[model samples]
Target: MTPPAALTLEFVSKHNVEGDLWIIVDSSVYDISKFATIHPGGLSVLLNGDIAGQDATKAFYGLHRSEILRRPQYARLKIGELVGRDEQQQNVPPDAIGSTSSIPYAEPTWLAPGYRSPYYKDSHRQFQLAVRQFVEDVIFPDAQRHEEDGKPPSQHVFDEMGRLNIIAMRLGPGKHLQGRALMRGIVKPEEFDHFHELIIAQELGRIHARGYSDGLGGGTCIGLPPILNFGKPVLRDKIVPDVLAGKKFISLAVTEAFAGSDVAGLKCHAKRVKDGWVVTGTYARLPESPKDRSVYVPLFSVFAARTDAGGLVVLVIPRSDGVQTKLIKTSYSTAAGTAYVTFDEVHVPYENTLGSDNGGLQVILSNFNHERWGLTCGAVSAQRTILEECLKWATQREVFGKPLASQAVVRSKLAQMIARVETSQNWLESITFQMVHMNYKEQASKLAGQIAFLKMFTSRNAQDTARDAVQLFGGRGITRSGMGKFIEHYHRTLLIDAVGGGAEDVLGDLGVRQALRMMPKNVRL
Candidate 1:
């Protein structure tokens, strides 16, 4: 309740002995006298003459991340301010929470100051700011905590997302959002477009926790769109309102044990029965399927299965007597709720069919362009974050008594990282513009291959960027914490982009196949 005392440098200088020590970081003074004995680096590291009673801002930053100071115990060590606002930390409380980065190439050029964009209007920019603030205040902290503990996102996050109607917005522009007050009316429903949704994905990706990012309504973003576009009115009314409200969960159950991305190769079968169908199949690695049985009871999912005569169909199946789920531990954190799901003779209502029984391929393909495009946006944003981190590390970190950026090799890696992310971002934005301008059918016919190629390019480049970032950071890059924590995590999880929605090789082949279909009949070659 009381203000911290204001102290001057001279008075703090005398208390430099073992029993008493003082240091200034970003102009705020910390009395690490008692803490010195218990400091993680040990008393000797804190007792150095240059740090014990001096302005150690640069030295501290060189060795530790700023977040270390934000921890309760370390923050409690701050006994007073250093008596000058101009010299104080730029991130002082109440003002420092969610400001955009000053680092060049940290954010998309459109988000950078003194930069202009043709795609984002005032509303999109405003919406992006609002979402970034929420993600910083809420999602990011939880992301770090859960990513380590391997737990799903907190319920408060789900409730907060629902309060903002973020779940529906992530599904992108649709009739489902007609009456909703999105972002507290920051943008009207009709005014909402794919770019707005892109902003949400990119902003959320800044959390730097890939597994946690997917857990935060990953299912709703990729799965619910099918229901919105194809489910019958009665089915839509029954399912849409509740799921959008964040009261329920749904995941796209397409990948199986045998069929990863080859949609036509899925062997899950549905036998015709009275009033509904009997589904028996396994849906593997469903992103964030509700695994908590007591709270959510039955997992609600929309999956693709083969009907009689070997025709693939898409249907909604609720958790029931024949349903089962087993968590699939992965290299990434378990916060994503990645599971291997089995449905043995599960009964789904006839009205639950997403589209015509045999049109599963079409039903699935209709959403693929949007899903793949969203993946590109997320991948570009994520890769860009890594680039910013690498840039910061290279600039601040000292190697051989000079800034790491001074090294010719480090600079070259940085250049390569920058080029990959910037090119991917440009391609992603161009495709986004097409999505905004074209109709759904037109998009499927014309933009499918383009989206596939864009995803392939973005994902492969992300792999390269991750490699360069790790190489630049060296040992620290591989370490899970400290200067290269994000770089390490990114290197470990970057594969999801290349393989999740579709494998890079498959996507590249599909793009070529699409091009082949549109080739001129009278080609000389």
Candidate 2:
């Protein structure tokens, strides 16, 4: 809809009272009167006499980031532009508005009009738009709320994701998504590729609340794949549909107190029982299990454990009689439901065993490539976001009577951050390109080492980006509220990506080991 005609400063001043309050920011006007009471910061800040009848650009930036002004909540309040500003200059072309942010490197290069990418096509673009809209309109608000409340996303959020077929699409390209209407009809199932999956991960990472991101669907992103790929057809048919539809929640139960990245070292053991298998073990701290079955379903856990044969086994254990969960608090919020799960002789039917008994290592290993790739995608996007935050903060914040961007030291940091982010993103795209062209078996053999290195490199870049971002954001960066929220949250949870998929040291070594296996037999060093 066209914005109401530009309003003069005099006209804005008249509506400054409690019931009809309006304020200007960057030459655009917002009617935030109705939003005052519900503002997360508080109502008094808006009602304060000093803010009435004035442009609130300074105060707004002081308490909130620029993204707030761009959110749909604030967008709807924007009735018009300031009277003296040039309309053409102030207005973004309709088509270009959300395609890319004005900040450099904030989005993929392909999203920028002048740039081109052979990897992305019209379907990819359509998919990106649909996912972005869904994230902004549906997921982001819930993420913000749950991030603060330390609760998982509401069922409505999951239901909406199910409706969009996002839960299924997130597993990366596969037969699972085939024949399904994806992203609510924006892209066909056959057209979905790794690039499309990458777009989803990056777009969701834009939420910037890692805990909330995990809480929303992050667990299922890594957890449900084993069941989908290796579970018996009867088992897959029984649970996969419900989980993908967001009626239930599942997690990959592999990490233990004794073993993290060293999957082979896991002590969780499965013993043969009369009818099936008896599994008993403890998972590394993860989020809490859902309490309400109607609103949520803690459906399944793909438990990886050792059998009597001294080889690994994977079981699809439903939340049942002997299963127990306790919440484990971490640096980030509890929204992720990070829990300490215990399977006390939990009985799993023989039919629930995924892949071959005592040969489940490959099943688990196969899932890691995509899992790490997803983490790499998120890490790179997050660093880009951090760079964007630094750029905006430097330009707007003043130090020693000049903008922070004017300082040579800050400029150097920004340059380094941008370079790292761009390089990682380019590498990630290249790997994704290979994924699109190669089949699953080819990817497993050819791209494993490359993906591992990419994850390691991207995560290492995140560590640097987070540190630099914290330095740039200063006191606000360390603080949780106000202008530095994204920086602070990212800094606190950056290790999740670095360590969760695979620790940097382990992955770096694994990449080298894998590459050596593919080394030429007779070539000189």
Candidate 3:
């Protein structure tokens, strides 16, 4: 196809009318005569006499973001470059424009060639590329489809993940991943650290299908840790391989209708029987359940419940007779298999007890640091995506004959969103670095409060970013399709991150309390 010829300023000016509207933006001319009526800001803005025959550069910048010019629908309307401008400078190579986003802060600082980071290495970059390709090519489509269909990712997805050892890799650096090949062997096991885990969480979040991301292996991410770290050797040997191989599903079930972060307030009871234990009560927001149609056989759950001894206990219970699950739909997709699980006289073998009889509190608490950190990583990454979306929207979406990004108010909101996201990401990296060097016990002792606070902070930041993105997107933000689907989904579901990993209020107080204990005797108020 022949390229469109460039139009002179005189030629552009001649077509400036209601019937033949033409406008110049960034030295390019667009014929928006047909788009006037459909423009969200209304027709008068496009038909104004002053804008009709002249360059609408200033006006266009005020409403639309730069990305709008790249949209196929708008790009096709381009008649040509301005008559006097250098053609080479005016026309950007298609490949360069398509490869990476031009909007500032649209990607992480590390992804930009001019920026440097001490944290990421060649392995991290290679791993990132492989994971991104996998997500974009394989996981993203599945996530979107399953999210819309209100179902979980297919078994084939799990099998593929199992083949690549992604399930084991997500658990962070541990003995379980020691021998496993990860990210198609892009990074060696011995070299894997919290940074690599951070990469995985962030990349997975890019799928933008939160529920489906959880469904793919969300349950296992949290559930298998206790079993692998503290369960009896026989139990660990029996369950770990199958779960990691994607032949089984497991989840952590600690919250109930009456008690969420208040672990001590749990009402589910487990009584010791002659040969085993009988558990009875309900657990809410479980990520995996046998009742979910997509789950395979041998579904398992690790939950904390009250024992007859009046102390909290953790049990790894398998789905069997008398174990019932009822779906509890939330703002996010049901692909997560959020469930109200009831263990009615369900027999759990003594061997199934994950930690010591009444010592389950430590086991449960031990997982929180990792869990909250994971939430922080995902939330921060999601916020970045939201920021990028807003940047693209503001640049491409014109209002009053200018790009939305050109508006001062929109720029202010974008600045705030970017600041919050960057702050959270830096904090997350700092905390992750600590995890890499500190032993588990040291991490639990020294970093718990910090992780809690970080999670709380990021959740709040996500709320702010989501709000700004929705406002920038306008109607499309609320609508489920088109440019706003991600922002819409994020707005509706961001609360899960705020409340799930430990509610913001709960964690905020916990951080202060934990910090108080570490205060020095010599330090005065």
Candidate 4:
């Protein structure tokens, strides 16, 4: 490295109208012209010479300096150290630059009866308002005491969430609530970015900042869909209603220490008994805050195991005498509680077997399509929050006699963040629209690829946005106090991308497999 460059700029000062000019900053060259119009931040940085170049170094310091060099666009560069270089004096990658052309936004138009006004409109808005008021009046105050003691938010807060019908958003109409898992696809599609589903994702993201958002949306995915889709009518009638009524909270506990993405490899096992089944396994818990001391006992555990018939099965086991829970400390505290569960010969009645004896794999697969999508929503929302936070900090934070937002470099960073969010959001919504209305059952092969693609993109985007938000916050971002808690939540939640439904690599492989299925027989993988 040559004493580290002061700054580097890559862009054509003058070029043919159709040509792209690559500009090199630090060790990497960026195809500024190609990025010009396509830049989500805007065209200003691209059109203006060296926006992120040498002269921009005044705003540079810690991670930003290293981050700029790590952009995928610069991976092929051979240079080291910036050492204050002029625009015309650097090397630009030849093929890296492309022709100047317009890039179209990928969002699709939302169509009718499905695109009806939001479910949270009119009376629903009042409900949301009342719920928020409750959070402020009762929950927030109680949460403060827990916060002071370094404990997770109070259980009263969660109970309040249940009382507000937040937990019942999917079951049926409660307090005039009519949104179902299916209808939510419609209402959420309208709110999503060009990607369509990203909008509903944002809503979940907001609720997540406060406390346990998993049981609500996550339950709707794995919990309701499975039993409703596969369980016997008696099981549906007996279990589904309470799950919908907020009387019970459902969570899928398939991920184990050794089997993260390998669902089929889960070690949990069940043995057949005269009446039903005996299940035994250890399920890991994320962690809990110690102050409030209100224990969260997981009443429902979705256990994946190989049945005596030599086929995979999912047993829905409710907490009973045989089931035991142990609290575990974890990285995130917003989630009031998490526990390691042990089922020592826990007996689940035959009626509780969610799907056919050997068809548990299908149930698990079906549940993922929606669960991954919910994560997509949360991930995108995380980006949206990062954007808002960055803008606020830029405009409000003063440095060296001027607000940080006044600097061209800072503005450029902000713009890049905005562009990234928009692009990801658009992709999210598009996939959501396809999922909600496209009837994937008839085209399982075709739908699989799209879902996997969206999952991978959205999760990565959320992680990236969280990282950027922390950077924008600087020292305050790393702290556990004040607004820092939000940043901490975002930081710890990175696992959400990889854990929830499937790993990024797993999704990518499934996407490729789906794409392969669409190919002609001769070319199939």
Candidate 5:
């Protein structure tokens, strides 16, 4: 952790040969003689006379991100710094991991310097910084590792999250946060409004691993809320604490093979029993239905089934006898815990029923509103990240001896990316403000259509942004690693936002139907 030694440029330049190659990047001296051999770009690129120890700062940054230098193995290569200067790395703030980006339009307007907003107060701002730090220190490494290995997130990460009560916070403003200190008391539990929760969602999307973002606790966010609101006291009291503490996992099981958006069409059924209910159903095991089912074995499932009366009944079915699950390799990383689940005569206690016996539709519909809003926050965050990446790359990357930004078409693409993300962020924030003032029932009635439309708009914009990003990043955008890794991941995981919570087309229809329901009977334009 000590500051590196200081070295003169004269001395650094002397070691430019193959056996003693050196480079100066952002006033830091790195001896790459040994590292060059194993460098992903190969030794030839580093050996070029112009770059060999001759302040390769420009060249180094041209093809790579600042994070690559932050890796321990690479960071340790900094034996010293330039003799008479401060250490200033490109694109890295002094407290880079937690600090806000200085890039124009890189962050939400409220986060930009000198920009102010009525929606976010001091508590919200401090909470945003703290959450971003927590995500970088606690979540980023795990996301990067598990995203590639296709493994579920590490338990230690979840343990840390639990220690910080982050798992509970992800569920948003509620009674669950009453006693727990949030972000080291930056914000009080009662004062923690929807904006605070919005910050958490936005910070999480910065992880850039959609699957891990969900895998982190996606199930709990959508699934537990239903039980907490409607389940019997006994059931809620027992399941709420454990899942919030990260001791267990839960996923919404409302979707089925036959029913993607049409919940009424699910074939899953539950027969009345002596003590509880005997539930049986076969899921198409599609991506949306049972996501995260097999991530952590023995997780609780909140699903619906048709009753003897032909009405839908919602229940919490614990994974036990006759419950089976199979993993499905998805287009994105398996860290999402994508799987097909089957409930063959699974028993559900009567106490586990949520809401009225035949009112299952309302439970799932309510859960969808929150899920859609969260997804919109994340979708906007992802688009902003792509915009930042493209901006940096366009400025530094040379095309035909001039910066790529010089190209008219590239600038046009960048402009579109900017407009789309900003519109989404602005709309998302406006909706979030409404959520803050409205009660749950009010939100259910007034904001559901607005939220549905907002999510549809944000996600659809995300697709266009992703495409523009691919066009801007070019081959590197499609490449799975290095410079375009995030772009590739975002482009690949379109299903999570666009299709998971609710398909775009279906949500669009829902928004329209809700609007039609509210139309004035006798009003004229």
Candidate 6:
């Protein structure tokens, strides 16, 4: 047989260049068709990439630069030394309808083996480590600063994310990979019982409120991913390096004043203009709780809009400009400073448009899978904290004539919490495994629903376990010097169970839909 043809590069010439299929290398066209379907912004973005290819490469800053580098699963592609003009050639349109293939990818050489992980054999495991280190070291410390500044923690926390390479991990070294692959590689479920994940979350949760919030979603979870997922290369170049380095910050602005889970029903709109787009709408902020004596500050948010070329798309309009943020204080996430942000004709450049116009819904939804999984991880950790705290109390605190450990009722509750943690953590790992291996097209399928359900389940269980721990502590539990802080945190975590990726009812419905899809046709009820 003839030697296998070299994996030749396809390029777009003056004759045939689609709107999104080609990229400019130096001066000539370079076909990124292989990366088209796998693009985090969805296929439409790739089409637009073709149209904006030259300008995209030339962009120095803004959202467009950020999106280009945010591919969720891009760690798999090799970053080859781009050849000069001599190797450039015309792109050959494939007879195939869409995308090059449907498969998960592997890590690139840039993520060398020596980097430090026992679970490197599994991509999901590597991803989990990335998230853990990021939250513990960078995000948490920033939250502590927010506690002092009376402002939300986004600015400083995100600035550090850019430094640690955490933000870059999503789309950093490999450009050819897809989101599903990176997600799966980050954390595999079965690796730990649900309780194990909970144990980690609990340890992190022990930090002050700001620290915990930042570690969870205060920055990394809500900030970097979206920009990376749909923003153009111009946006990517400006934002990613900074956010990864902790120099900048960003956040998701999907939950509206009226709409919570019904993303498709958003009322926000972006009117098109000659140079760019203008977004106008209101975002709600949480009201502060009296129980929380700590000082609280608020933040404005960017909003999502639908444009002529792209449907349901999002933009990052800062609090300083035409945008306004109203703080809606709540009992939870005191460190986060929840708020409702309203936009009034916020101008966004043509290049600032993230992903394809009207593709915002898909862009936002596609990213939820990871967000949900992360919440589950955090929730599990919260439960572990409850167990650890209860254990400490049981061994020391006297009950009646004996230590609480001798009480059957207390032991029952502690054991139950541990059991629940185990169940949730194991499920989390299993789901993580499936995520790493999941095909591109199937990313939003039944498995996505599983992630949602796990998030709901884990969050609820974590809340309940925390409550039980406080109850078990009896008198000491209610005091600030005793379990007071833990009890305060317990209530705070309950709110998280319903928000980050989705609410319980929403995830339940999604799980139902997924279950229905998995049934055989003849088995209809």
Error of 4 at 279 (Å): 1.2
Model 3 lDDT per residue over 1-525, tens place: 232475778878887777678888768877888887788888888877768867887667555545578778888988777878765436443333113456687667887768898888999888887877776767877898988997878777778878999889899887888877897788899999999889889988877888877777778888999999889999998899988888788899888888878887899999988887889998774575233474332277898889899988899888787887777788888888888778888899999998888888888888888989987888888888888888877776888878788999999998999899888888888888888889988998899999999999999888888888889988889988766888999999889899887899999999999999999888967
Local accuracy of candidate 6 as per-residue lDDT tens digits, 63-109? 13222233344423323223333433332222232121111111111
| Arranged by lDDT, best first | 1, 5, 2, 3, 4, 6
Off by over 4 Å in 3: 1-102, 289-298
Model 3 earns a TM-score of 0.83
Candidate closer to the true structure by lDDT (higher is better), 2 or 6: 2
**Residue range 164-249, candidate 1, lDDT tens digits:** 99988998888888989999999999999999999998988778888877777877787888888889999888888878777777
Q: Cα deviation of 338 in candidate 3 (Å)?
A: 0.5
lDDT (tens digit, per residue) of candidate 5 on 1-525 = 233355877778888888788898888888888888898878899989888978888887778878778779998888786877654543344446788988899999999989899888999888888888888888898999988987888877777778788889888888889999887788889898889889989999888888777777877888889998898889988888878777777877776888888888877999989898998887633222232344443368788888998888888888786888777677877787766788888888899999988888888788888989988888889889889989989988888999999999999999999999898898888988888898989998888888888888888888888898898888999999878888999999965688877888888888899999999999897
Best first by TM-score, ranked:
1, 5, 2, 3, 4, 6
> Which model scores highest in lDDT?
1
| Top candidate (TM-score) | 1
Task: Give the C-alpha lDDT of model 6.
Answer: 0.54
Note the Cα lDDT for every prediction shown.
Answer: 0.84, 0.82, 0.82, 0.56, 0.83, 0.54
TM-score of each: 0.94, 0.87, 0.83, 0.65, 0.93, 0.64
lDDT of 4 by residue, 31-62 (tens): 44545556555655433454433333222221
**Candidate 4 lowest-lDDT run of ten:** 97-106
| Cα distance off (Å), candidate 6, residue 393 | 0.6
Residue 67 accuracy (lDDT) in model 1: 80
The global Cα lDDT (0 to 1) of model 1 is: 0.84
Model 4 off-target regions past 4 Å? 1-201, 207-211, 215-221, 285-295, 334-336, 440-443, 483-485, 522-525
